[model samples]
Structures are given as structure tokens and as C-alpha cells.
Target: MSHTLLSSPLQGFTDFKFRNAFNHFFGGIDTFYAPYIRLNGKMVIKNSYKRDIALENNTELEVIPQIITNDVDEFLFVSKYIRELGYKELNWNLGCPYPMVTKRGMGSGLIHDSKKIDSILHRVHNESDVLVSMKMRMGYENPEEILDTLPILDKYPLKNIAIHARIGKQLYKGGTDLGAFQKCLDNTKHKMYYNGDITSVAAFKELQERFPSIDHWMIGRGLIADPFLPSMIKNNTTEYPKNKIDIFSEFHDRIFKEYDAALSGPTPIRMKMLGFWEYFSQSFENPQKTYKKIKKAKSVKNYTIAVREILKEAKR
Candidate 1:
């Protein structure tokens, strides 16, 4: 299979609308995996998770819906639901490291309990008619701890194993544990895809040189950081990614206009728009100045005014 690059889910950032708009403008990601559906015991999806990946007629990209649960029935419930919607693959989120998720004996927390992992995977695979995939970290508290569970995962017929290389306890704070990742490649019969810290062309190239066997690469924060990493990785064509600051202002205004209408209030809209600026600032000539302008805006009116003024200055 000729593999295509993909965008990993980043909770609030890369939802249905964001993916639709991104693929419309900049062609990079081959397929997107939606944020995990946090289901209750009744095998019913929470409303917010349901909304995050709900397919629209306008959503044109290839998407794999995902689920987060420790229960086999919930896993089966999600897989069946997505399959009926025409998605052939459903990814299981074993990588989320948040305390709340882990505390519930879900996400990476389940990695420690091999018997449960074995039981759940066996039951889900035996029951589900759709393809099952897994996204995971190296381990929960320590990288080597995952080694204990690899034998169990190898028994199941998984579509692919996407490893983030960092332990769950580390969250997104530390560097990838390349040693543990290498161990997975060495031991597991299942095919592998790499994810983590791929924020720039150079970093991606280094990963390519290091592991030429890998066919797919997934980006999370980096996609949001620049919104152009996929194009950069795919075609090496962002050789001249638009440097003019005015264009970013144009992009920001366009997204903000959309968010304001869809979201409930100014606080939510403002927070979302501001989050984009964290990565958007990297596109500026003076990153610090542009970031401050967005960060310091006092009101919704001021935010829009600052955006317009800075965009004008960008033309100078």
C-alpha cells in the first residue's frame, strides 16, 4: 500500500469542521482519526464525543472514528456504530494519559493490567465485524513497562499500532522514548506507525532517515502549530510557505468568524481562536510580537482590531 500521512486527534483542535476546512485549503493528511469517543457503560456515546466526529455530507476526507473505553461491550458498540456509517476502521485509544481517564483504568492505565487487556481485546475482536486499530504510548509510568503487554497485543488481529513513544505519565511534556519504540518494532508482528514531536520538515526527515520502514506518520500539536506540516511532509513543497503576516490574519479572521457563529459564547470562541495563535505565531517574522498582540487583546473587539492592524502592518 502506498501510505499517506495522517493527522492524529488533538481533542478540541482537529474536529470535524477543522479537518474539513484544513483539507479544503491545504492538502496534507491522507486520513484523519477522530478524537476518542468516551462512552458510558450503557454502550452509548457521550454527546460531545458524538458531535466531535459526526460525519457531515460536506466532510470530504477519509476519517476513522475512535473510541476510549475499558469495557469490551463499549468497544464493540463504538466499532459497530462507525462501521454502519461506512468507516471500515475504528482506532482504540490506549494512549490518552490524562489522570481522569487513567484513574478509571482506561487509556494507558489498562496497559498495566495485561489480563484485562487480553480479555477486552479478545472479546472485541471475536465480536466486532469491523477492522480494529490501536493508538498508544510506550507505557503508563515507565517506557519498559509496556514490554509486559506486547505479547498480549500481538495475539489480536489489529489493523495497525500507532505509538507516540512517550510514557503515559509523562503526558505530552517530555521527549519520545525512542528506545522503547525500537523495542516494539523489534518484537511486534503487527505493522507500526510513528507519532510524536514531528513539528518541522527537518525533524520529520530525521525520523524518515532513522526508520525508513515506517509507512505512515501522524501529527497532532504540530499540525495545529503551523497548519502546514502535512504539506511540508507530503510534497516538500511548502519550500515557500506563505511568510506574509497578512495572510495569517486573513486565515484567523476567517476561522474566528466561523467559530463565533457555531460556539456558544465569547469565552469559548476566544479560547479556541487564541489556541490557534500558539502555532500560528511561528509563521511570523517576529514570533514574539505577533503572539503578544493576540495574547494581550482585551476584548473581542480588540482582538479583531489587533488582527486587522497587524495584517495591515504585514503588508508594509
Candidate 2:
């Protein structure tokens, strides 16, 4: 059976620059979800969010805009804003597990509050025509939280629900609960897409065999760890392209140059690239050393040299 692969949105990593560069270089993800738009107690959409979903910025890809909020008004506001931008769908993020967000009764924390989920979906469906979908963890504190919320979600016509298979408190630390995920499959009437720990072709194959009913798969950190993953999965191959190092080097330089131009100073760019290397290092033979090499580069010149040496060594 064929599969539809989606690039799951990561807060700071999968921006327009990275998306475009990844699409150009890797070429497997069927769609990309822009990181959640947070209103921050204001009804305003940040310029950064605007730039991310701007049609011009994402012309080459099928992109979906996502919003992280518990406010109905904020949901409507962002929905209208994106509608005006010619986007027809908005993905609601209820999967974020960060303490700061969950403490406020948003993201995964909202799962336990079925009434609020019902109310918010109620108002949004009544007031807006924008198609809705969801990204969620099974629960914040426990897997059963989503079971209570799932019935409320069934009332609305959500496009689909992508589940990460772990609860909020786990915060990507423990293994995904396949048994809980199976329970989710049995409970919900909505189309369910699977997301979590799909890091390699072998891992993806394991999931495909485990859940033959699911055709849509969302890849989060796995894509960043190895951009080649999605395409390799699509081709049904375990081997990478012969020029993996050269391709990765070019892909890295593209994002680095683009981000370097977009961000103001060396410190910001360094920190940004460093954040990415936390995942990118996993692609190298020596993950810790590769990350340490990037982390130790205090100057931009030194960072460039470090990357060059890493890639050259990778080729050999």
C-alpha cells in the first residue's frame, strides 16, 4: 500500500527556510505543517507567523497552518486570517507537552477538559468555514484523557486527527504507547494519522506492518535527524543515495545561508544552527562528537570550518 508522509511541525526548526530547503533537497514529504501560531494573550498574528504561511514563501509545497490556543476567539481570528491568505485548512495543536504551555490548559493539557474541547469546537464550527484538523498527544497526564475528549471531537467534522502516541508528561522521553495507540484506533471515528519515533525506513516499516489501516504518517524529529528518511521510506529502500554526504552538505549550506541572512546577528544564527545540530548530529557516525564540534564553534568562521570538516569526514 502507498503512504502519505507529512512533515510534523517543530516549534523553531521547521520554518519556511528549512521547509523549502528540505523539500528541495530531500523530496518525499507530501505536505508540511507550519509550527503553531500562538497569540500570546493578544489577537494579533506575529510577523514571523505571517511570513511562515505566506503563499509566496511556500509556493512549491503543500503547507498547512497550525495554531496552538485554547481560545475560541483566537482560533476564529487565526482562521479568518489564514482564510484571507487563501489557505483552506488550519491544524489545531493539542500535542505540545512543554510545561509552560500545558500549565495554561492548552496543548496536551486540554485533553482532560472534554467540555472545553467541545465548547471550542462548537463555537469554531458555528462561526467559521475553515476546515479543521487536530494534532494531539493521547493525554497530558495519562492516555485515557484523550478517550474522554475523542467523543467530543466526534461531534464536529474535523478533517483528521494526528496522534503522537505519547502523553504530555512523557515529553518524548519514553517509548510511544502502541497499546494505547491501538485503543485510540478502536475508539475514534475520525481518520487517524500516526506520528512518533519514525526515524528510519526500518522503523517506518515496523509501524506500517503494525497499523495497516493508517496511510497518513507524520514525521517530527526523525525528518530533521535524517532528511533522507521520508524519501527512503517512499522508495521502500533501506539504502541512502550514494552521494548522501554531498547532498546533506548542500542542504545544510542552503538553510545556513538563508537563516544567516534572515536572522540579525551571529549569536542568533549560531544558536539556531546549534539547536538544529542537536538533531542533525544524530545523522553522523559520532553523534556526540559531531554535536560537540558544532557546539564548540564560538565564531561563525569556526562553525563553517567545523561543518566542512564533519561532512568531509562523513564522505570518507
Per-prediction CA RMSD (Å): 2.2, 0.6
Candidate 2: lDDT over CA atoms? Answer: 0.96
Best by lDDT: 2
Per-candidate TM-scores read 0.92, 0.99
**Which regions of candidate 2 deviate over 4 angstroms?**
none
Candidate 1, residues 54-166: lDDT per residue as tens digits?
A: 67632688888888889888888888887877778889888998999999988888778889989988888788778888898888988876788888999988889999989
For candidate 2, the TM-score is: 0.99
Cα-based lDDT for every prediction = 0.81, 0.96
Tell me the lDDT of model 1 at 277: 78
Q: Name the lDDT value of residue 137 in candidate 1.
A: 88
Q: TM-score of the candidate numbered 1?
A: 0.92
- Tens digits of per-residue lDDT for model 2, 1-316: 8899999999999999999999999999999999999997898888999999999999999999999999999999999999999999999999999999999999999999999989999999999999999999999999999999898999999999999999999999989999999999999899999999999998999999999999999999999999999999999998999999989989999999999999999999999999999999999999999999999999999999999999989988
